[model samples]
Target: MIMRRPAVAGQFYPGNENDLRELIKKLAPEHTPSKIPALGVVAPHAGYIYSGRVAAEVYASIEEAPTFVILGPNHYMYGSAVALSTQEWMTPLGNVQVDEDFIDCLPIGIIDKDELAHRSEHSIEVQIPFLQYFFKDFKIVPIALGLQDYDTIKELAGELVKAIEKYDERVVIIASSDFTHYEDVDVAHRKDRALIKTIEQLDVPAFYDELYRINASTCGYGPIGAMMMACRERGAKYGKLLRYATSGDVTGDRQVVGYAGIAVY
Candidate 1:
């Protein structure tokens, strides 16, 4: 099996195993994850120092599961709206096995096995280590979404629901995304709050509507929208915001990328 090694390791997070472990622990510092069932979660995908704490908060709230369906934006990839990979992903912590079997089970017919689409992408890659930190031996099905069209996301959500029923597996869905990018801190908060409000209500239509209404720049919104639909299908009533921050918090810059951690159960 081809190994999907880290492409942004040294730049986005620690390159060494010990250092990576220390950083994760330092960010979490005795954080205890919830045992309650989780249908889906949303976490940021920037560098660890800027977004790790918030990501950890959402991860901490999710109950342990054998498999995770991780959806992330295709920031650099092209050609396919949905790119699915069936390879082991390597991170500083260790190798996270891809759920190849589950990947084959998805009912969506538009997806393609496009490893090249994931080669230079950091969004999904950034979430692997956090999953490794939380669970000892869990597989992940990583999909990079390049489009945020409404009908596409809605159809993908329905397919996911059918796939879950066909497989009869208890899985957790995760969306790796930043709230808003390169906006003034005040404007970023306003845009992100509007987006988060829709998220909390689990209103897929409102979620998609407000995204364009406010001109929000969430890179992985397609995945977030799909996960929200899956959450609602699985009986998730609401989403709780765990944490929200921005690059400005770390760099002291006026222009920042908004980040948030939300859990749906």
Candidate 2:
């Protein structure tokens, strides 16, 4: 079987298993997680020190699931519009089994096996340690999408719903995205709020419209939009913002990247 090792291990997170486990323990919140399970969640994909706390907070709120469908943006744009991986993802913590069953069932237009697209993408990889920290036994379906129009995302969502039904009923959808990249801290906040509002309201179409019209500088808007549709189709009524922050909060930088953890229930 092909093993997909970490591409950003030493850079974005610890490359050693012991160190990774310890860092996650340190960053985790100290409150009991809610019993309410979420259908989907949106988490940031920055380095651990910058966005780990927010990601951990949102993760702490989720209930158990058999599988996780992680959707992320293709920052490098090396593969197909929607790329899937057949290999297992190797993190410092351990190897995460990819839900090959689900990937095989996905329509070709929705997702195709493309290891190159996932090889160097940090967006989806950053969230795996959190999964390792939170659950003992669960598989993942990692999808990387390029800049696709809303119509494309809508079609992908329908395929995703069918894939989920064919794969696992107990699943949690996660979209890895960093909002408002490399803007003034104030400007980043302003732009990210627009995206967050749509996420909290669980407005899929409005999210696409705002991302285009307002030019909300989010890198993974497509992933978020796809998750919104998946959540809606799964019968989620509302979404809530668990936490929000920017890189400026960790580093004293004028130009910052906005980060947030949103829960869709």
| Local accuracy of candidate 2 as per-residue lDDT tens digits, 40-109 | 9999999999999999888877887878999999999998878887789999988999876766777766
- Report model 1's TM-score to 2 decimal places: 0.96
- CA lDDT, candidate 1, residue 119: 89
Per-candidate TM vs. native? Answer: 0.96, 0.95
lDDT of each: 0.86, 0.87
Off by over 4 Å in 2: none
Query: What are the clashing pairs of model 2?
Result: none
- The number of clashing residue pairs in model 1 is 0
lDDT of 2 at 91: 92
Off by over 4 Å in 1: 29-33
- Per-residue lDDT of candidate 1, residues 220-251 (tens digit): 89999999998899889999888899999999
